[model samples]
Target: MEGDSKVVESKPHLGIPEAVFVEDVAKYLKEQGSCTCEEALKKLEENYQKYKLMEVNLLQKKQRLKQQIPDLKSSLDIVKHMKSIEGTDTTMTTNFFLSGALHAKAKIPPTKEVCLWLGANVMLSYSIEEALGVLNKNYTTAISHLDSVNKDLEYLRDQFTTTEVMLARLYNWNVKQRRAAKATTNGSD
Candidate 1:
């Protein structure tokens, strides 16, 4: 029996030299004696090559996504700036028209046509002022609402961070308890 075992051990085998530290796996495969070592090595090499290719692909995707983040942020900033400028221009134009009409109304003599023009200008200015006041109030309200939303989001983010840390601690404790229980069960067996 000892001589036969020696003969078996002397034969070259798949996964033996490469995995010398893994005694249990080596013993199991040696018992099977199914495939040559060269075949297993080739398969492992192919798998490693495929894994490397997948890693490269994932790294490329990560780099591309990182590049996009700054560009998207800049675009968002540009859009916000443009909207602010547009709002200011609109307000200036409205103010200019109102001031010009007021100046003309004051200087012009009150002939029938001039009185009619003055009346129209005054009515239009009043309507514009009313509309502007409503819009200003609405803009203030919108800003307050956006501030509330940002505060809520910040609170939620902090809560989520705390919960994540708590979850990690719980998971570690659970793993320790499970391992202790398994060890106790195995000792009894």
Candidate 2:
């Protein structure tokens, strides 16, 4: 037996078969795909938060502008009334409130002209109509700016919705791939 040559069969080392390869490839793809999808979702969530914060800020800004408009309109009405009263009386006496409070009051002489604040601590003497014109212009500008903010908010909302849909689709695809890979492995085994 030692001198004679013995015929021995050697095993073939085929790296992997077709079925196993399919299952492994599917599993690897699912894992990698899901990881990428999760990262994307996280980034999308960050963007969503930023967008929501920006939306809130925009709303607040618009609200401030709207509030200013109403107050300005009230001031304009008061100025119109004052202009009418100024021409009628040569010397007018009115109660002045101390500390700008209604409770504390004192008598004071009112003149014909009134000083109006333009902007940034800038003041100028103007007739009633001129003051009214300035206030009206400011009101219109605020209104237009608010409209622009509304449009921007709408665009941001659309983008947020799109990202949400994309995230959902990616999640669904990941789940389906995982299930398919599991089924392939189980069937092969």
Candidate 3:
């Protein structure tokens, strides 16, 4: 099994770019010294909004992948079970759904071939060995993709926290700046 498994590289595009790292609030304000605190706050708010939107998208994708992984595993299991019984003389019979609320029974015959449904109303017949290979490849691919999605989600959550912190810090800095300006005016008068 170890020989069959290969390391799949996660796509780099799945995570946020390095350029978007959370900035230090004080450093950001210092760098933008010419701009007023309100402007810096507005920029920070925009960053927060962008992070929120990305989180929404990633959450949706994660939900879909979570649902799909189970289905892939189920299909793989069924195929493996079928392959296991191929050589045994034990006759297999089972009830199958014909349609909505309709059922029929069919006897299974030992054979080298199996049919696989490839979505979009397509089906293909292959030898048991070939079918197993296809199913295994698909299962591995789905598992790897799910792992990538999960990692991306974790990274995105960190980004959300960082952005929220920056927003709060920038807002507080803005308030302090306003208080200092008001004090100077009153004192000068």
Candidate 4:
């Protein structure tokens, strides 16, 4: 009911049939006898139980999914570690060959170029590691936020559904009461 007005306004055409059906049901209930209230209450209780079961099943599934997040993080960490080591090996091989070539040419070949290459490799490695760290941090943060949001949504869904069931039960009871009163008055006449 929180956003009922907005929903009604948003789907004016689509809601027409549903509104008509509701009106028809109301009219039928008005003609029912004394047993209508009890029938309506029973129907509401049954619907509440069904919703309760559905909520429980969905929450269980959510919990299982939440539990998998840590495992996923661990697997990602392992992959990052393996990749870093592979990068270091590749850098070392390249440096070894480059440095050897520069030193082989005596007469004191300028080492600036070799130094630049080595410096670049170091910077690249550092950047890669830093990026991985940031990625891991972000992954954990996102999972944490998702878990919290899912929990809050589950609570709200259950609350709203329960309230709806109760309201429906009350409305049905009132309609039934009206029908019973009319029936008694007509019978007495």
Candidate 5:
């Protein structure tokens, strides 16, 4: 998606988000300098669609990231609970659900260290406190990433709205000029 749509920020327009520079807007405007009203309208519509596409993609990515946050935070909480039960024979049962249906429960190993699934089919042995630290760090990082994505999405929305407004203004201005010109020409005859 990133390769499919790119918004180059050479210079941002007024009232638009600083993070987004609709270079196409400037390019099209420059091209329309010598073109007719219809041509300028076409250019504005084309540029408007591009920004809209960007907004949609950003929204999708932000939603996916948001879904992951809850799961990651849940894991962090479990590890924190394990940290609380550190020494004593807390007798915790681990449950696994396959395909969101079948459930299997088993007793955790009777040892001070626990196995942590570190992704890519890899598992590592770590003490309860160590596991808590790792999960906490992961949750923190995920949260930070989510926040960044949210901020970007917001800025993208702002840019989209600003561009749309600018295009509408341009269209209205063109229509008014054409109307006034027609009126003056008709009166002269």
Candidate 6:
């Protein structure tokens, strides 16, 4: 039924296996000695699924990091701008977006401290210098994380290609073996 849902057992996340060469599939089958082609195919299919799932997760993470890095840079820029204007008697004026297509004009009075939202319904006041330091640190960390994610995505793509090639080679080997057996049986008859 399309509406039916099954409860699945939760297991700890499994690490992805190292990619195997296409020729290695034959060695693996020979080592098994009695593993049917069907069995080997099933195992390879499962491994492929694991790699696909991990790749999907990494892509989602990359998308989030791409969006977050820009916002972080923007926040850092605003804080830096404020610091540059410090010690001057000029009030800061800017347009704040209230919602889609609506803007509100705001004038920020000169002050020694600025309030920063720290997420989860909490905000804290900090000196302009302190705010700059915090924003810069956050920006750097996000960039580093994005770089790591990109590297992982590259590795995953390689694994995907390797698994597909292995599957094809194993299937071809199985078909040739079946044909050879059939020919021998017919000749004996």
**Model 1, range 1-189, lDDT digits (tens) per residue?**
999998777543211222122224335346648843344445445544543454455455446545544544443443333344542433212111356456322222111110112224462222333444444454455455545444443443444444344334434544675799899999999
Q: Candidates sorted by TM-score, descending order?
A: 6, 3, 5, 2, 4, 1
Stretches of candidate 1 exceeding 4 Å from the true structure = 1-126
TM-score of each: 0.34, 0.61, 0.78, 0.41, 0.68, 0.84
Quality of model 6 by C-alpha lDDT: 0.81
Overall local distance difference test of candidate 1? 0.42
Model 2 misplaced regions, further than 4 Å: 1-35, 90-112, 117-125
**Residue by residue across 89-177, what tens digits does model 6's lDDT show?**
87889888889999999988677788887779999999988988888888899898888888778777888898899888889888988
Candidate with better lDDT, 5 vs 6: 6
State in Å the error of residue 95, model 5.
2.4
Better of 2 and 4 by TM-score: 2
Model 3 lDDT per residue over 1-189, tens place: 554453223335464632234356567767777876678767767766776787788778878878877877876776677777888886567677789999999888777888888889999999988988998888888778778877877777776777677667778777887899999999999
Tens-place lDDT per residue, model 2, 109-181, is 3445667766699999987678778777877887788787777667666666766665566567668868999
Off by over 4 Å in 3: 1-13, 18-26, 97-103
Best-matching candidate per lDDT = 6
List, residue by residue over 59-133, the lDDT tens digit for candidate 5. Answer: 777687688778778777766666666676776687876666888997753456767777799999988778878
Count the clashes in each prediction: 1, 0, 0, 0, 0, 0
**Model 5 TM-score on a 0 to 1 scale:** 0.68
Candidate 1 vs candidate 6: the lDDT winner is 6
lDDT of each residue in 36-66, candidate 4, tens digit only: 6557556556655655665666566567657
Instruction: Order the candidates by lDDT, highest first.
Output: 6, 3, 5, 2, 4, 1
- The Cα local distance difference test for each model comes to 0.42, 0.63, 0.74, 0.52, 0.68, 0.81
Cα displacement (Å) at residue 62, model 1: 27
